[model samples]
Target chain A: QQPVQSPQAVILREGEDAVINCSSSKALYSVHWYRQKHGEAPVFLMILLKGGEQKGHEKISASFNEKKQQSSLYLTASQLSYSGTYFCGTEYNNNDMRFGAGTRLTVKP
Target chain B: EAGVVQSPRYKIIEKKQPVAFWCNPISGHNTLYWYLQNLGQGPELLIRYENEEAVDDSQLPKDRFSAERLKGVDSTLKIQPAELGDSAVYLCASSPGGRWGNEQFFGPGTRLTVL
Candidate 1:
């Protein structure tokens, strides 16, 4: 089944912070995050593996909770370029990767 | 190294027509995936290929959609008698194998518009 994302949409001013959460009922082996701009393909941001691993890229960071089958992406000091839709894709033991509905983030100057 | 490449960035066709999109994955990546993305939505996997073999395609609409990754390097997705509902962006992604947390690189995608 596909994961669920919270805060369907969010608006932030420059330098603000935001968090997008993803949860799944099934056990997740990994959670992958991507950001997509208008009319473009989704770009890879980070992937969180099992055992509570945290990965960081620039001002974006994410954490995976194996027990809760959930993950959260944190965007710190948001920039206008950070405005995009964020998607979290979950993978189970069977290699079936499912993505959440996505969170639309608009960062205004 | 170049990222995934796709052709025909945008296409407009009438319903019932046939359309095709092409993709070239990054070198040495064994896993390739094709996904469909509607406006304001996340991508949904249509098929996944492990080299020249299609390991998973349960979500593919076989009645109207088909895909092939011959020689395990380049792939193509086709839709016959395309319906208006098929009007969406077709994205291709690839990743290296044998890793529990490998990242998949995505192409710019082909946007299809069926009228």
Candidate 2:
């Protein structure tokens, strides 16, 4: 099943921050985060695995809670470049994988 | 390395017509995936290929949708009798191997418009 994302959309000013959460009903082995700009392909941001592993950009980080089957992405001091639609993909082992609807974030100058 | 490649960035077809999208993953990538993205939504997986073998296609509309990854490098997704609802952006992504939740690279995608 697909993961669930909160805050369908968010708008923030430069230097502000935003948080996007993704949760799944089933057990999660890994969570992948991606960002897609207008008229472009989704770019890989980071991948968090079980055991609370977190990996991604310095300014952009995420945490994976294996017990809760959820991952939350934290964008600090948001920049105009960070404006885009963020998607969270969850994996239930190597074969089962799906993505959430996505969170649209707009960082205004 | 060159990123994933896809052909015909956009397509327009009348309802009930046939449409196809193609993708070429990064060289040596062993896993490939096709996903459909409706406007204002995240991509939904349509099929996944481990080499030339399709491993996950449960979400694909098998009745009218088909995909192929011959030679395990490039892939194609075809839809027959497409409906208006089929109008969406088809994205192709690829990963290096079976690494757990490895990062995937994506192609520009083909935006289909069914009128």
* Top of the candidates by DockQ: 2
Give candidate 1 misplaced runs (Cα > 4 Å): A54-56
C-alpha RMSD of each candidate structure in angstroms: 1.3, 1.2
Candidate 1 CAPRI classification by DockQ: medium
Local distance difference test, per candidate?
A: 0.91, 0.91
Q: Mind giving the per-residue lDDT tens digits that candidate 2 earns over A2-102?
A: 89999889999999989999999999889999999999999989999887666677767888888888889999999999999999999998745698999
Interface root-mean-square deviation, each candidate: 1.4, 1.2
Q: What is the interface RMSD of candidate 1, in Å?
A: 1.4
lDDT, candidate 1, A1-109, per-residue tens: 8999999999999999999999999998889999998987788898888876645476678878888998999999999999999999999964579999999999999
lDDT of 1 at A22: 99
lDDT string, candidate 2, B8-114, tens digits? 89999999999989999999898999999999999999999999999999999998999999999899999998999999999999988755436789999999999
What TM-score, computed on C-alpha atoms, does each candidate reach? 0.96, 0.96
Clashing pairs in 2: none
